[model samples]
Target: MNAHAATDTAASSTTALPLKEQLVLVTGGARGLGAAISAAFLDAGAKVVVNYRSSSQAAEELAAAFPGQALALQADVRDAAGLKDLAAAAAEHFGRPITTLVNNALVDFSFNADARSKADELSAEELTAQFAGSVLAPVAAIQAVLPSMRQAGFGRIVNIGTNLFQHPVVPYHDYTATKAALLSLTRTFADDLGPEGINVNMVSGGLLRTTDASAATPEEVFDLIASGTPLRRVTSPAELADAVLFFASPLSRGVTGQNLIVDGGLVKG
Candidate 1:
């Protein structure tokens, strides 16, 4: 079949398997925002593969809550072989192909504006590391799951981005630049994969109220951000996770190659 025809085939095939039946693999799903995303998928009645590099205890604990519906696997997102193994193991355990992927893993980063490396002080190594985790990792993951998704003719790839791309309130130079690059990948991937019935999009969130990475943020900074937003409150991990669910869910079937900002109206895009 042609690319367009194949997409139609995949679209028609997906109607039989709703969100509740989807098999979702979330990278770095053992803690913080990753944990929330895993929980959101599980709560929606989808089988989740929680992939974590470390944080075994956290990953297992989160999976334990859902019993048979969730599984915790170990894999570094930057490793293509590991990601491929993770996909195979998840399918073997869940008895189905992975239908959705959430690229949420990020390198170790803190939200302390004061501690940020200034432009002149930043090193190429720092940018390279962020690129590995933020951009290359997602690329590896998408490659690992492409065969299954293409065969099934249905896939949802949601990349976790940052509001810093639009509003560079804090110069997290390395982190923000990599995320911007990921957004470019998001759009290009959407165009390339849409013909195969895969929807690639991005969810960019502001400084969350509390995540492991944001734990070091000053109280005043949080308040300052909240006061500047229309919601007058910081966004929660759960709230951001829900937006991911929307993309994974059938409700967003027609939407692709777009970036949805879920930061309490902080950065309107």
Candidate 2:
């Protein structure tokens, strides 16, 4: 969505606190799609805690821009202890439990054709690493935050997914498999947490342009994607941010355990 459209929505939602007093933790919030998501939450007046592994400078800069409203934290999702520490720090800083958790981290985004490996060629370590970031880490974060959310009786957990998992444009076997597993986790968590007033959902989108993650994508690949999509254009991180906000906001209170595809009709199934 364009800035003007987002501003309109924000204006409409201004009657409430605009997630201002709400504590939110967004993983991989240093750059790319994560950065856009963080910015969206910030614009909505949410108290954002941005988690990053190596992008410390970027994270700190983003947080500094928002002053007291943002906190840049360093935590590697692969490290369970580190994840717990970050979660604890976020809770401590907010002086209240986090009400929203956005699991937007990922590893092994390599799209090299020559690097493709089938099941037989894939190593156990590779599979484990992929799943650790895409699935296990999110699960751990959810576990860490569930008690607080349950106590407060309100929560929103959003898992970032990819449209490529459904379309298979490229054979990112390990990445696709792990993301598919995360989608399943989203539904399962939603079903398990619904009674507690917590909602779990997934947002899947096609190749998003202007993000660091998609910088490696060839121009021809994007051309092909735009031609194939009904919107005749690649999705943008800002556009996907709207879908994420919908899930986090009161607008989608009943939308749990669902995968909302924002690929501009690239994968209608």
Candidate 3:
């Protein structure tokens, strides 16, 4: 999933376009893993629209690093109308339709097991917020981009998910449940959109070594998780970002509805 590997390749399928020729809209592409994803696409020569709800300064800085190739636009992914405006602004600025999307926006949450609400303690409000970010926002994002993708007959949608649904080692009730729902939507979207030449997929990761959200995780816990994995190391944001490129690139044109885990062999699927 190196930049050159994705950039040097020819078209992978009849409708699959090269990475350099694509314009990508990345939701919450301002910081943490989102920033890494944005950087990966930019490095692969793709024009990127880095959408941020708040982190305006960080978003602007990331766009500044890429000059004309990246634009930091503000939009709340939870709002469909806002997302539509985001898509329009991106296409207007880039002068090309956005053929790729990375749904990596995350609601405020920490990975500290002790801090997470237990099943019995989880509130309806917590579940609702998670659902808005995980399931509803993605639906809105897809709707926002579907028109252009339909017009071009090409699209790549990558949903950011977590492996907790499969292993549930910590059982983050609200967060894990919504992400599992997202995985289901990923498959259904793939089936519904495949005929139109669009690929919808998910990239699930275990607790990353250190993202802003996971910064609260204990150091010993990271060491323990790493030791359990065959790779004997926690996955980095850059490493997971590379896996995302696989789905967004022509490499995965024939693939859809699959959740590829990028947690250094922690959960083999």
Candidate 4:
């Protein structure tokens, strides 16, 4: 489906504020797609914790726009203890356990093919770093939230991923490999947490039209991607952000361990 149509579908499918009385913690929620995701939940009348590792100014600025509905905090997701502190801080700030967790924090990796290391040239350290940042970070955050989720018998965990794995038009080895592992973790978590009323899922996006990271990509590349998609345009961070809301809402209470690809039909789910 086209981006607009997909959004309409999501809006109709959403349950609004199934967790209206609870809090949401979005890792890397300061900028890029993370910003949109945080805003979406806030617009739905949910309080949010916008977590950032370094973008303090940007994070605070964004949080200011929402006032009491949102707050910005800093934590490196790669640190398990740090994730614990983040969850504690967020619960203290909102006076509630976080009912939703979005693992949107990303490691420092570039989409520039020339700068990316090929399989043969990629270092063990590079792969390990990506894993720690992407996979282990979410694992830590999930672990941190499990106690509360179990207590309440409710939770939502959305892991942001790339649709590149579905369409490997670009050889982003390290980034894609880490996301693949994360996808696996998403399903496993879903299975393990289903009985406890926790849902784990993934929202994968293709080349976003323009984001801080994709800004470096050539315009010609964006046009090429747009032309190939059925929508004849690249997906926007806003659209992907809306898609991420699905799993968090009660509309998706019955859905888990699923990957929804939002790439303008360039890559089918």
Question: Candidate 3: what lDDT?
Answer: 0.92
For model 3, where is the 10-residue window of minimal lDDT?
6-15
Quote each prediction's TM-score: 0.95, 0.90, 0.94, 0.92
Give lDDT per model, in order.
0.91, 0.85, 0.92, 0.85
Residue ranges of candidate 2 with Cα displaced over 4 Å: 1-18, 118-120
Cα lDDT for residue 246, model 2? 88
Question: What is the model-wide C-alpha lDDT for candidate 1?
Answer: 0.91
lDDT string for model 1 (1-269, tens) is 89999988766766335789799999999899999999999989999999999799999999999999999999989999999999999999988899999999987778888898998899999999999999999999999999878767689999999999899978799999999999999999999998787999999999998999999998999999999999999999999999999999878888999999999998876
Segments in model 3 whose C-alpha atoms lie over 4 Å from true places: 1-13
Task: Please list the residue runs of candidate 4 whose C-alpha ends up more than 4 Å from where it truly belongs after superposition.
Answer: 1-19
TM-score of 4: 0.92
Q: Please provide, for model 4 over 34-151, each residue's C-alpha lDDT reduced to its tens digit, 9 standing for 90 to 100.
A: 8888889889889999999889998899889989989998998888998898788877887777888999988686567767787789898888998898888899989988876665
Better model by TM-score: candidate 2 vs candidate 4: 4
Checking candidate 1 for backbone clashes, the offending pairs are none
- Clash numbers, per candidate: 0, 2, 0, 0
